[model samples]
Target chain A: AQRVTQVQPTGSSQWGEEVTLDCSYETSEYFYRIFWYRQLFSGEMVFLIYQPSFDTQNQRSGRYSVVFQKSFKSISLVISASQPEDSGTYFCALSELGTNTGKLTFGDGTVLTVKP
Target chain B: NAGVIQTPRHKVTGKGQEATLWCEPISGHSAVFWYRQTIVQGLEFLTYFRNQAPIDDSGMPKERFSAQMPNQSHSTLKIQSTQPQDSAVYLCASSLDITGSQNTLYFGAGTRLSVL
Candidate 1:
């Protein structure tokens, strides 16, 4: 069984500031991937970033980056220079490589509110 | 590419009625996944298919819930005798393939189901 946990239910940040959302997972599989997704107010979910368990390097895409700590089985998504449009629900998901189903176990999500 | 397409962005049903959701995966994608999301339960994996074949459905309810992917293009998830507790946003996602280290999933806007 794989489980993802997002300790912060809600987070608020000012424009141009950095916001970090934490995520932790528990899985028996040695190989898996962690993903970050943002659900806009329009109800569409967009992919933000992803980090593989095998890779020790932290992944960064635009203003979105991930702090992957394999030894602690934890990952964090950092949004730099946040803007008002960045306000949305951020979900952390896990996919186990052992299962061919490609099903993702997602966290409860952290709702972010960026104020101008 | 239009990404993954989910029809009936919103649906309302009476108790004991049936609700069916549809999804069209990416053209060359081989894996499709279904998930349900709510404010309380967050995101829950329902089922998935690989190359039009039923794979793991461990997350689906044993009764009253069913899913099928008859071809590589489309899939459907049907819930019989829908209950109020079943009300949630159903999300569909697709991936090129489940193998390899990086399996990034593309998601649709999702269908919001409401049972009264």
Candidate 2:
């Protein structure tokens, strides 16, 4: 079985503040991938980040970056310079490739609110 | 890209009713995914497909949940004997199939289901 965990259920920060969302996963396969998505109040699910394995290059999109740790089975998303528009739910995910199927398993999201 | 498209932005049903959610992946995408989201449970993976084939459905509830992708372009998730606990936002996502390790998912706005 594969599992992903996001410990923080809610987080809030003022404008220009920085925040971090935590994630952890358990899988038997050594190779893994991580994903981060944002869901707003309107119920739109948006793609934010995708990281493949411990050796895969870290992905950066403006203010978002994730650190991948293979030994501890953990990953974290760091959001810098938060804005009101960034208020939403953030999700962490894990996936592994196989001969049979490919599926991404997700964690309970962290709800983030950025105050203006 | 139009990204992933899910129909019936919202639906309301009574207990024991049947509900079907649809998803159309990006034009050339070969992988599709389904998920359920609620305030209490957050995001939960339901099932996914690769190249129009049922991949892993370990996340789906055995009693009432079923998913299918008969063609490469679209997939459907059907829930029979729906319960109040089934009320949540259903999200559909798609990705390329080069390798499960290189998967980058594009998501839809999601179908918000409310049970009365």
Top candidate on TM-score is: 1
In the predicted model 1, the residue pairs found to clash are none
* CA error at residue A50 for candidate 1, angstroms: 0.7
**Candidate 2 TM-score, C-alpha based:** 0.89
Clashes of 2: 0
Overall lDDT per candidate, in order of appearance: 0.92, 0.85
Q: Write the per-residue lDDT of candidate 2 for residues B1-116, one digit (tens) a residue.
A: 68789999999999999999999999888889898888787777788888888877877999999999988888999999899999999999888763745478888999998888
How many Å off is the CA of A66 in candidate 2? 1.7
lDDT, model 1, position B109: 96
Q: Give per-residue CA lDDT, model 1, range A1-109, as digits (tens).
A: 7899999999999999999999999999988999999999978889999998898899999999999999999999999999999999999999898865567889989
lDDT of 2 by residue, A27-91 (tens): 88766678898988888878888777756566778899987777788888988898999999998
